[model samples]
Target: MSTTIPGPVLQEADWHRLLLLRATRPDVVARAYAERRRPGRLLSERGTMFLLAADHPARGALTVGGDALAMSDRRSLLARIVAALEHPDVDGVLGTPDVVEELLLLGALDGKVVIGSMNRGGLDGATWTMDDRFTAYDAAQLAACRLDGGKMLLRMDDRDPATATTIESCAQAVSELAQQGLMAMVEPLPYQRREDGSLVLCKNTRDLARAVTVASGLGTTSAYTWLKLPACDEPEVVFGATTLPCVVLGGVPGPDPEQDLRSWGRSLTHPAVRGLVVGRALLYPADGDVKASVDAAARVLRAVQPSARV
Candidate 1:
């Protein structure tokens, strides 16, 4: 009993010391304590991700319904997007914030995964090429809107340091989004400068590997990172680049829709390839049947993973 008499005094002394220390360094102590708590929560199973192919406007090839830059026509684009969202197989949409915001305004985004396109300043025919600015939505802006994720394009022209800067900024953006526990799809391409001062993207096996390596090396954690890759000239070459999940991009629409769909479907079967992010091929089809085209595209996506049956 006599030996235990010092216990209460020591405890009281320790409490007083902590209180005094905290008072002197309130902000630091509070930050440390707050950080000990969880940062945020992840989306639930209700969050079904999909391949969003809204790349037309970025390239300024928005010719839906025979209207050049038809995607720029907000009303028409919104209607088509709403129709696609209504489909049972569609889990999400990938587009710039202009489109995403329009969907939100129309109340079409509830329970849907909305991915914001983050770069488009490097317009298709720009003179000062390779300076791809972040002209679209950003991570912070996305988070503010309660959006799911963000995506960026990285076309590397080694000769152009401007493109290199875009790459560096993208790397930093990836880290930022990772910290927020949101997905950031980084689509990288090794490009060459032509004699006419135009940048041509490479789809060769070697170039594909380099792009994958560069992308994979970015950011702190890659758990939420995905790759938006082009359907390579040789599907096998694209498949060999990285084991990371990939969604194939739909370039300009070809004359043959069925052949295009078949090729897209085959790419879906590749082990690492998840789905297709096709835009013009689906939205601006020659027939002008948006729903029919979207349905066909969805069919291809569903076929990739049999378990993803609608």
Candidate 2:
């Protein structure tokens, strides 16, 4: 892999300049948003998507790997995002309103698939974490901003009554986004509250399958619903639960990068699997090589080329 910077690097000086622009001439953000080049289709010619996920921080989930504050610095995070988007294989970006606005102001989202992340009201360790409310970009905002779609995190906890509210909100969002012909990327994660009152992902194959089934039938219509899921031990089973187009998420990169890559490659071979909506695995890799890590995953997506488009 090459070590060259693909696009304009956001250095310390660049960050300072952005701050000045934001403080003095705030209209540039709006102008940048208006001037952003939108993509004609979500997928590329080979029928694959490589979206960068940056919405985790909005939910107060900023911890990546061993570093507790790995994503705490805005400048560093934006720099990584800019570098990732410069890569040819990176399709688009999925982020909350703030992150999206910052990226737009930086002019890094041109010709990219911009998806707004909705329902980030569920704070990471809050007692009401199950109540994933629509506290971010709504359908109307997404359309107004010319974003390609809206993504929501739907974690269903059987014991938590707040899960019901989340389901209802997600259903409404799905319907609303569909009405505008926008993608509603929903991630249905089955979670279990630990004995210590913390939430942990239920990666069991059966649970994931159940979550997929529930998510696939959320809205009044499933015309524009897309499932963003984590590839589990039983990749086929996790994906077999739905007929909807699925995009695998690159959860925190595991200790073994080779195994992680292989898992993603195997899942991409699934008929329903369209592409990848990854974040930390590519942006904050074990080797700290953002470009190389992104390129490696791009190669995995391209390796399993389908005979037809989804």
Candidate 3:
């Protein structure tokens, strides 16, 4: 990681400041981590959260639609993220350590609800992708960093023996995070192994509902667990399976951004859905205007969610 002052937000003097601080003051990151401010309440009276997701690159899954390396450029990605954060409705961001630390240094994370992504070793298109390894923040690490929560990718495939191990790991993480009084945002997506041995997420209403119940029941205590689910058709069927608060996730970008937003809007009508955590679709949109795309999504959020007393 070159210590260039991460985004377009920095002036020339800031670059020098960054390099010098990195070379002479290695303790700065720890200090920054220790000193980053939090929003105090995870879900304010607005009653819904709109988080930008930036943890994809760590999984070696950077392609946004047709572009193979849409997120490979750190400068561009950080700039887009900073732009998205400028929106008033945007509650926070979820990312791996590298991205989070960079934003922290750039002062882009103050008073935000930061969620640390917990697993990344299960690279995209890998033969063993289902067993997803926990390579990023653990429960203790999240607690020390004072992050609001930890997110785990749970792709449950009945055919894969590795699913058991991943489930056990996620269960422990959920329990540990709960003990620390932190949110455990678990993405419990149902997966199916094809005849060719490739695993694919089963997006049907039934499978998704099953995954939700399974995820909601993880750990000794479900008090601190939240489900990150797909914004599927029949949101009631999928979301009705659990009483746990759910956040709909944006998957790969579709050709039509407006269509995607409409689908997400429908899901928000379901009472169980609290908000959305969108990534490529919101960050790297088809129109290539990150801020406009973010604002559009924000509008969808504001339009659908009922007004609550703050």
For TM-score, the strongest prediction is 2
Query: How do these models rank on TM-score, best leading?
Result: 2, 3, 1
lDDT of 1 at 244: 68
Candidate 1 per-residue C-alpha lDDT over 104-174 given as tens digits, one digit per residue, 9 for 90 to 100: 44556565666788888888777655777888877877666566778888889878888877888888889
Instruction: After the best TM-score superposition of candidate 3, give how far the Cα of residue 31 lies from its true spot, in angstroms.
Output: 0.8
Total clashing pairs for each candidate:
1, 0, 0
Query: What C-alpha lDDT does candidate 1 achieve relative to the native structure?
Result: 0.67
lDDT of 3 at 105: 82
- Ranking the candidates on lDDT from highest down gives 2, 3, 1
Q: Per-model C-alpha lDDT, please?
A: 0.67, 0.87, 0.86
Q: On a 0 to 100 scale, what is the lDDT of residue 25 in model 2?
A: 92
lDDT of 3 by residue, 228-295 (tens): 99889899899899888889998877778888899898888888888999988887765567778889
**What is candidate 2's CA lDDT for residue 96?**
94
Better of 2 and 3 by lDDT: 2
